[model samples]
Target: MLGVVRTLTALDRLLDVLPVLADDMRVETRFAVAEGSAFARNLADELHRCQAQVVTWDEATGKDFDLAISPSSNGPLHELEVPVVTLPHGAGHHKLRATETGVAQEVSGLSRDQLMHEGRVVPAVVGLSHPDQLAELRRNCPEAVPRAALIGDPCFARLQVSLPMREQYRESLGTGRRTLVLLASTWGRDSLFGRRGDLARELVATLPADYQVALVLHPNIWNKYDGLQIDSWTRSARRGGLILVPRLRKWQAALIAADVVVSDHGSLALYAAALGKPLLLGAFGHDEVVPGSPMELLGERARRLQPGDLRAQIDAARPVPGHRQLAELTFQDRPYQRLRTLIYQRLELPEPPWPAHPEPVDPFTP
Candidate 1:
């Protein structure tokens, strides 16, 4: 199997599926980090940690594979000669990106241009996490609909299994008897960092000793600007007791540890809501969000972060009333089993005798 990883986020999502094929002695999975994405950093090192064999993009293209799988649709996905499976790297597809002309915008991955290359569909199987997305695919890229497969999200499956480990995660983060406030931000100008870069610093400085503050930023921020830039940007926050979650991992542990979560329209926010945590929309980029999407609905149901005493707001926060609805929309039952079935069918192999299960996520690394 060929794993075409484009960015850190993509790598994170791909990790959820790779374990299913890991234990099979008959299979070998080689990873290749597709070039051109600014957020593609430490990929080789991360892959090495997994003990996965790393191949150059050139070599990946030169060799033949039984099947190729990628968590992202971006980059050179069409170059692979074998059957390719493409999946959403986040909580479904809820964001929009500008067209090449910069005049019009469309759903990021569902657009025909993104799903096709040279007048042909790119992925042999386009994985969809929800049933609603299939309708969206029909509306956006009708030609790709026949190829679309309703594969449940592997990341959410892992998170669900990790729910019982929340206390262990909190202990690892050293939140001893204190309320942990997790701030999550996506990338780009409209994200929390872009809107309020000093929010973490101010929260750490202002929140009493009974509360601990931690910031989890999208990997794009760290790789696009480099760690030194982020350190410079959040030096005071770090000094004032801010915990910046590691870029490559442990963000999920932070979510599991959080007593309350402040976020924009990122997938972390959606995941937090699904976990039934008290959620506050610190900053939401409405223009970039898809209308009537699950995220847009989250924006409407979630409490807005009002100005003035942040402590008072935190104290008064309640779990989003729509959280159960969000959870229902975000995941499907028995995802790992479904994923294993999908992959084996694509590989033309018989099903394994043992039941498929998602490994519990690792605890907080910091």
Candidate 2:
């Protein structure tokens, strides 16, 4: 049995790890989530679909579990008695330097993610994707990074193997006849397509019918801005041939099917480029308050665009050498099993049979 604490994007990371744990019936999982997060209900649905129980985290509850794993640097971790393992939540991958300017501050922010939860070190060991990330952390936050464990992102492990989502992606989103384009957007006024006159609508409005646009929105956008800015474009775009990606599973499928990617400097860009997709930057990367990321190494390969000039190429942009290198830097091969192994090693549990489900029914969801 294990406990998990998730903040915003870590819900998808939790989804990635659940498949490795699913086949093991002996291991029951419980997730502790903040009561007030926007996506709490969506997470409830997702957790039920994944067959895990949920616990509402209240600081005064003082509940203790056998082991706890948190997937975010910014989770609601407080006084807990068990050994807590903190998984990477898309930060801590670059060298750090103090700065006040936007660009340098962006670089500094990567390693120095404003140590959250009252400056309490959350994890007994911090999980990392590469040794380089560890070194970067050591130079920046020596106290924390020294306990780093090189566990590649379990999410990008799918790219290390043959894609399983190709057919389903085509089935749900489209037939394979069109050139697939993925437009992944984050939320807030800082988002890529937040107030930008609907890029998906514009893409389908401008691009020829030989293309397909799949837009996977961040869950926060789905929850917080539901009937507001998100609705402004999604319904209209769907009417105009945009394939609205619903959840992380389908989002991964879209990534598998995508030939070209348009995103901000968010996790989607990192995951897409980590899987070797041609990337283009929307307005989000160029003018955002979200700290810059090492994932931008691959994002910089593409042409940056303002909201008005969203362009499409007849042929997909070729992923450069830097894309693959940064991807390899971000992901490890066989990560699900490696994460499983690490869990067993850390928690001193017996190894469970980690088998591949050739046709996993909804994979992480019911």
Candidate 3:
């Protein structure tokens, strides 16, 4: 059994590669959650669909797994004795070291300088978030070049909606016909938007009058900003000829349906880019901002949203042909194939043919 320890965003990518492995191999997978939080429950629910077992740290000791797969940094799981593969969740600097603990692990997705600085002290594997990321990683961790595996952003491989749901989602959310989907989440303290209230108002004021705006709030924001009157906000936007739909829907469905998406630095923009939807990324607080990210790999398909520039950006937003093509080329390449092979090989299983028409798992149902 492969033990996966990570967040839902990380699991989103794992699910994409795991099924291909599970279908052809003899391995039974399970999740080892750190705590029984909402994120854990969501992860457990998704894993259950694959018929994988789910366990918590309190229930099962960390030593039980044959191999531990962490889609995020495994630095937190250093105490475990199992051989671990760490797939960093994002593109940035990472410090890899033994850290006063005895755990042999490799950290993927770091610049070359970062790897050079830390590789001397710890076992590390470097993978790029973009072509540049790989270049930087090699420059920093020269030794890691041989062992480095190009496992792309796991988030790129999330399950999308089925054809039926796609149509239903379109009808329910007004996806087609010059529509803009606003993916809202709670901005961190250091975010440029400062407060959720300020961002919401800015969105209301800035969006074009002719466009239909669907505000899909993240689950976390639903609880935190419950006091804000969504109906009133929608009414104000409606007066400007913008249709504001406040009811939430699955992120995948929204991404697929949207003509363009305006979101802060979150997984939604990534999903949009994967689907070839035009994306305008909003820069949040200080820490959330990365001047250039894998998102830029989308080229004209995406742009960083600037203050007082929303109208012009929205006007220029158009679905680019190479959006999904580049994404597949860069992140969904052979390294992902290797990860799939590793999962199957570990399970001692044969490979399954790729499903021509895999049904999208319903987010509401699971």
Candidate 4:
């Protein structure tokens, strides 16, 4: 099996399922970093940490394989001869990104132009997390609908599996009894950080001693601008008791540990809501989100963060009533297992002997 990585987010999502295949002696997994995303930084380092056998994109495209899997569709997937599976790298692909020409926008992952080339579909199966996405794809890219598969979401599955470990996660973060407020942001000129970069500092300064504040930035932000730049941007906030969670690792645990999450239209918000955490949309970029996506529904129903008594807002925040609807949209209970089956089918191999149950993610560490 070959894993195609385009961004840290893609890599993060890919890592969730690769272990299922890698554990089987019958399968061999190699990683190829597709060169395109500005957020591709630190991918090599992450692959190194996993001790993954790395191959160049040139090599990946030149050679044929049993199957290729990627959580992103950004690369030249059409060039590959092998059966490719395109997976969602986030919460059900609800954002709209500009086309290559910067002239018009399409739903990020469902574009026919992105999924096909020369009047042929690229991926053998386009993996989606929900049935709603299947409908959305039909509306946006009808030609690709025949290839769509509902693979569920391994990341959200892992998050759910990690819920029982919440206290351990909190202890790791040193939040013994304090109310934890997690501020999450996606990367863009319209994200929470873009709208109010100093919100973390302001929360830290305004909230009482019984409260703990942490920031969870999207990997794109960290990579596009680098960590040194981020530290410099949040230096004062760091000094003011705001915990800047590392981009790659701690955000998951922090989300599990948080009492309330303040975020934008990022996947984290959707995940937090689905997990039944009190959520507030700190800044939502309406223009960038899909018109009728679950995220858009969330933005409509969830409370909007406002400038005021931060503590009161935190205290009064409640999980959105629409959270169950979001959860329903996510589909199955076990995603990795489903993914393993799909992969084996794609590779024309028998199922592995061992179970493919999701393991709890490691505890958060600073």
Better of 3 and 4 by TM-score: 4
Segments of candidate 1 deviating more than 4 angstroms: 98-104
Writing each residue's lDDT as its tens digit, candidate 1 over 14-93 gives: 88888787578888888999876766777788788878799988878875688889998888888777898999999998
Ranked candidates (TM-score, high to low): 1, 4, 2, 3
- State how far residue 61 of model 3 sits from its true place (Å): 4.9
Which window of 10 residues has the lowest lDDT sum in candidate 4? Answer: 97-106
lDDT of 2 by residue, 1-366 (tens): 455644346676666666766666666777766454445566656667767677756532354466677675543454566666777655334422323453343333224453324565556767777666656566556667656777776666654443665666566565468888888876555567665547788888878888888788876676665545555656778788787776555566677777788877667777776666777767554444322345546555655655443453425355645777776666665566667777877768888755632232231111
| Residue 4 in model 1: lDDT | 90
Segments of candidate 4 deviating more than 4 angstroms: 100-105
State each model's CA lDDT, in order.
0.87, 0.62, 0.49, 0.85
lDDT of 4 by residue, 1-366 (tens): 789998888878887877677567877888888887767877878888878899877778866578999888777888777889999888888888555444236778888777888898888999998877888788778999999988898888889989999999999999999999999999787899999898998998888889999999998888888889999999988887888998675688999999999999899999999999999888998888888888888989999888877788888899988788778875556788888889888888999788988777887666
Which stretches of model 3 miss by more than 4 angstroms? 22-25, 35-52, 58-63, 88-132, 139-146, 153-168, 172-178, 184-212, 216-249, 284-293, 296-316, 319-330, 334-336, 352-366
lDDT of 3 by residue, 171-290 (tens): 666444655555444234422233443544555577654555555554334334342655554466555444443323355555555667766544455556666667665653323333
Cα RMSD (Å) per model? 1.6, 4.4, 7.1, 1.6
TM-score-superior candidate, 1 or 3:
1
Cα deviation of 344, candidate 1, in Å: 0.6
Please give me the total number of clashing residue pairs in predicted model 1: 0
Scanning candidate 3 in windows of ten residues, the lowest lDDT window is 91-100
Decide which is better by lDDT, 1 or 2.
1
